[model samples]
Target: MSTRSTDPPPIRSRIDRALIRGAAGATAVLLLTSCATLSSGNGERDNVPEDVSTDITDEPVELTLAYTDDPPSTELVEGFTEQHPNVSIELQQTPFTDYVKTVTLSMSSDEAPDIAQYNPGAMRSLIPSGHVMDLEPYVEAYGWEESFPEATLEPLRADEDATRFGTGSLYAVPGALSVLGVFYNRELLARAGVEEPPATFEEFEDALAAVDEEGIAPFSVGGLEVGGFQVWNTLLNAFGDHEAYRDWVHGAPGSTIETDEAMTATGILTRWVEAGYIPESANATSDDDAKAAFGNGESAFLMIGNWAAFEMEEALGEDVGFFLLPGEDPDQVPMTSGSSVSYTVSSGTEHPDVAAAFLDYLSSPEAARIQLDTGFMPVDTDASTGEGGVLEEINSVYGTAAEQDGIVPFPDFATPGMIDQLTPGVQGLIAGSTDEETFLSDLQAEWDRVHG
Candidate 1:
């Protein structure tokens, strides 16, 4: 029943400025040197200083944070400053499309903000340039390892080369959590004679077929953007090897996406495309358009993250429902890809301890309430939603995945530019212009280019 403004601030102008500056600067940095060389003399390679306490002085402190996500960012900052009245936080909001590029330049610049949102695309360069702080010390002092979920922290860790993940030093901590899943319209399903949410892959397809038979679009996907890949990601999680997928995404040496599981997942998606489950014009549709279509009752299902929950609820009321994509069998181990709206401290911050304290505050019960109110899952998994609805359903499924150690990082996270490959590759699959082999091979090639 928590309420807060979920509308993101307008950032088109800011995004344009940030993208121009970031692309020009980041490109030069990427070509001029390797990450190892840039990070070599930072002196932070060793453990964080033991005396680097979490304690902040009573003297008034003002900090700047550069971020893209608004609801949680603005609300979380309010919660932190309410507790520490003397401290003030100024937020710099940017559009997600421009965030990675822009934040990279900002982090590397001399007047970097005290804190910046964690973007892996930017981190590959920032972590190596000694611009971002290694937060292991703050983690120990704050006991964040215990406060936050391990799966939430794994993707944020990386080697000095910024290649491998799920190991090495911790860099960022999640302020909020989100899981990818299937969102369905209850009325649409009922019209199609679906008694309940599907329990297995076969049943899920049956529902799709039933919906299509009733002249309804069975699925809504924005193949032009991340939506296309997300559909494949959910399918792979349901059908593939979790450990292998994790290893590949984490940049483990010799890890790959070319496997029987991946092939089977791709083939299933191909079959769905051929069966007209996914619309032919999906490749031209934007993510917003697809979400709108689902919200307007133009489609029955949306394969996306909980970030869309608030909007869906607003549009469909109690008619909208959510569930994790079912596996081949009902008893298959719970698994899905998730990530955090996380942040990192800047190495140039004058108030490192204060920044760390802000990060620590994210795990508090107060911040958990803000996170859920702002349409994000709390880092503290046990935080209650206090009632039953879509959020409860999501938490139920996400909780099961978390408890069983089944959550995995997203596939696009495998490399800096993997999204570029995945989007078009999925577009090809949807268009029937690419085979399963080409799609996975393209992904592995991007991984090898970065990890080699």
Candidate 2:
């Protein structure tokens, strides 16, 4: 049950900034260049199938699926194929790093898979070239709005120009979900005299200080990678306005990350670094190393996504627990950075309905079990994740955020080059080389480069 051995897939780990940086920039250029002709091309293909059916035909149908994530993607396909004995799904999996670079091209080719994994960056061009089908038709045909959480569907949507997101045509459906939150070592918390998970932001800080006083490292941060900015991401979700952040990430006109709440969140992270809650050595630590350190009882808390649950649960057993980074107002609606392992049908597919059926199966009760067992939150948030465990805890917290439509895109999704700024900027914060103002300003500058 150890999800980690020596190497892990990027989907199960932090986003690899280097892998996607150049590829994303190239994809953005495609989006920009295509904007002039995308409208005409968008109308050329009838994205909607004339006959939409949720039911698959009994006639033997062969479909190919391209994906990168294994546990859920492979197992989910098997689950779907099992239910429809007459249908065969061939899975094409590429490594996460290579997938980002190659998927866009593959998706636009003449022989694209019937179904392909959804990548926001890939969609920038795939969507405009009329290679990717807009899933709005499937969404209505299958009643996905009732099955999958709206929050999970938001990022999969984008304008025809592929500039703004969280609105316009639906492009994909989530098979499994992940959310950002705090993972704590129970014994360490108790040793620090904290009896329960903090219910408010104020209580959380006090607990961190208490753990510090108890001579326990307050946080095991992957400051060397996505772990660094994720601390600020969760804090911003706690303190900042969700809509504002969403708008900024989706590239709303004149949207800016240089807000008062953003400043406060950045400042709070700076204060935590100064307080020695986050170690300076974190700048050199990989996410895997940091998680291992936490598993070894080196830190009281680690803020990360639920993708770490299976590994953490196997390592710590009942000694670990999870909770969202609590908000300043106890009554505030829960909001968090959440993303999904989603799949989309190719626009050129002859069996669009059959391909759509595979997506529909993702929200079924059966797939929910596979999704949870694979260390991902099920798209069907209402589906039971069984009795108590860190997995259940994650499902519980994620369901609350989903119900209120509070799960938003990770900050890295703001732009192609944003993670480049985030990881290094946060390293500066942790290293005391970057001020909060500079960090926020740098982020805004990157945002302007793409979104301006």
Candidate 3:
């Protein structure tokens, strides 16, 4: 989702530049900002119930939860395990780089966890194979649909034309909540003499230019393989003149990435690399490295999700800020975001009722507060529009853009292995191994392979 940036120059100087941009050749920096577990006013709240716990049965009804390493948010989880002591859980952490494959192999096994942490494409394979359960009945009985915002369920709900859309039935429960947006440092802007973050694209570029004159990197990206893909993927949705964003994602044949809008975004992104507005070496940088660089003040901006809030605060301190990624056309979608996180009942579960109960419990307004306090957009209805919870500053941008009908889901969330198909080509694009025409053609080729 797009973050709302203060007008003129939403980003300022609190950049932590010491974080190294590492993917291929770059090294990571160790610039640490002031440490205090920063919060924007009412940061984290004691929202977890006095007896916060998971429902685990002691009769060996065990499930394993798989997650990639982002350990800070689990701050309170370890302290709240008393309620459901009967159930035991195994925590499996994978590197973000290896998560996709690890999830795939585990799912195909009979020994798969009854409950596991699943991401976008992981459920696609299982849902289609009838390996997962349909949660609709449970959803109805529990009123999950009533309290649940339909948008939050978009990732789980397959379109009626499932063959055409590849949205298949809901499979895994959504675990994490995240928001994707362009991040900037306030102190960096002040050093560049920029007054505020730009509301429009032209001004945004101007800020990049101001940062450029000082010989500092203006943007950070993990362009090699998946790293380089994030920025391009983001821009594709923001400026997608054609509805190619979803079509390209669903891969329902003839879905080429070479739409006019796709080409424009690619060209501009490539130019950003050439102009040094972004690090030319981003082609080899990992996502972590780029994030660290931005946090350490080596770069001026980062296009990232809300989960990275803690990391940024750790690297850049209280002076850090965010804003919406400006779209080429304001009337177009403000910017695109992924469903990122959601919860669904496992089709294989014998205790569907119990699982569904857990989801409902997790969706409560109180639950939403727990999530907001974790620094993410909540699926709960109240948090999205209720009192000033979460970052009102950031939510203002997201809410305004969404209200204007300016939101789109991430391409990967719409289909299976979009990242698998799109990333190599984007990495190729960055290296100039493929021209704009061929990049689109390749994208279409992948789409055809999947649909036909």
Candidate 4:
């Protein structure tokens, strides 16, 4: 099993610092302190040379990688080295809680790794400072645009300022993917008279009501962390316009989240709270505790991602089932929030070609198998999902989303402080202390602080 902490890092302070410095003077300051500083080459964006090559050196070469996720990272490194026997990668890992700050500092220091795991919020500073290489040249050379899914690559592109993403130069490449969905307890759902998974949004609400009427907790929520907003996020996916939401998240000019559809989605959660569908103590519940409760059958459902599939399947076996949260129109394309275990090449790296080669391997058929075995959706969606059960269910839904061009970045990707706003804002909604307008307004305010 992976040892990465499920807990999100304490992000407010580090993120704010990175944004402020990244937007203004972070690059200049970083260059002063680091020996591996890039030259301000004439007319070059991010100081990356126009002449990029896809070939790696056959002679002995060594590279270091710093990352948080292990199941894929360690095994992926081993896989790459196995293919290119002359190249060796030394792995340096940090816990998820410390990964952002640790990597941000190290990537600017003389000791920067050749590659580092990419976190949009934490690593925004690296973009402007030119600490990370812009990979558009490599993308053209390797024809990644043709091989990788466009939906997966969209989140990795950002303008130079880092204020917006989903367009502009590519900074990272995905190795594995994850999608948000609902996990239901089969026995509990049957007990509540839900014969099968709901295919429409209204049907989903009826299921929740039925489960509540049966005296079973309808949902297990992790209000203390990302679970709460993720619930809202899924609802917004069902009710809101996919492109508008993506634009807002990408920091498009004049985009806003305070919409009628958003209000409608938030109102649904409010009604759920009033109906006691969500637990009263949810605001204090951590994600792990909430997932554990669902696994033990204390709750009828948990809205989470595929990352929880391994443990859920292990605990409940055939009793646990997975499905994407249905949309308002049953026939509408599936839209859901997803992210990747993606990697970025540091500009300071001595072996840019080798690092890029590692990224390219992620889309290979062999790497796809490692991604699947490690409990993540493979970067190559064409790879076969496992034989049966929750893992297959997840891959099936994720494939549909990817094929339809319906996947989107998580809302927290909008800005660094967005998570700080979302966690507390959703907590107030669960506690009935914050109204829908207030909750959304708080989010927009945080976005404005960074991107206005």
Clashing pairs for model 2 are none
Name the lDDT of candidate 1. 0.81
**lDDT of each model, Cα atoms only?**
0.81, 0.80, 0.54, 0.81
lDDT of 2 at 256: 90
**lDDT string, candidate 4, 1-452, tens digits:** 01122222211111122322233321111111112223455734353635566666667889999988766787778767767777899999988767778888999888899999888865578888888888888898889998899999998998987778999999999988888889999999899889899999899989998988899999999888878988998888888888989998888988889999899999999999998888999999999899899988899899988888877888899999999888778999998888888899888887777788789989987677777777788898878754788888888899999999989878888886677788789899999999999999998887788778
lDDT of 2 by residue, 1-452 (tens): 00011112443422223432323222111111110111234457545454465655667889999987777787777766766767799989887667766788888777889898887777777778778887776688789888888898888889988888889999999888888899999999999899999999999999999999999999999887778888988899998878899999888989999999999999999999888998889999989899999988999999988888878888899999999998888888888888888898888887777788789888877778778777888888987766689988999989998888878888877776677888899899999999988999999999898889
What's the ranking of the predictions by TM-score, best on top? Answer: 2, 4, 1, 3
Cα misplacement distance, residue 168 of candidate 2 (Å): 0.6
Off by over 4 Å in 1: 1-47
Residue range with the least summed lDDT across 10 consecutive positions in model 4: 25-34
- How many clashes (backbone N, Cα, C below 3 Å) per candidate? 0, 0, 41, 0
Looking at candidate 4, what is the lDDT of residue 202?
Answer: 90
Could you tell which candidate, 1 or 2, scores higher by lDDT?
1
Distance from true location, Cα of 250 in model 2, Å: 1.0
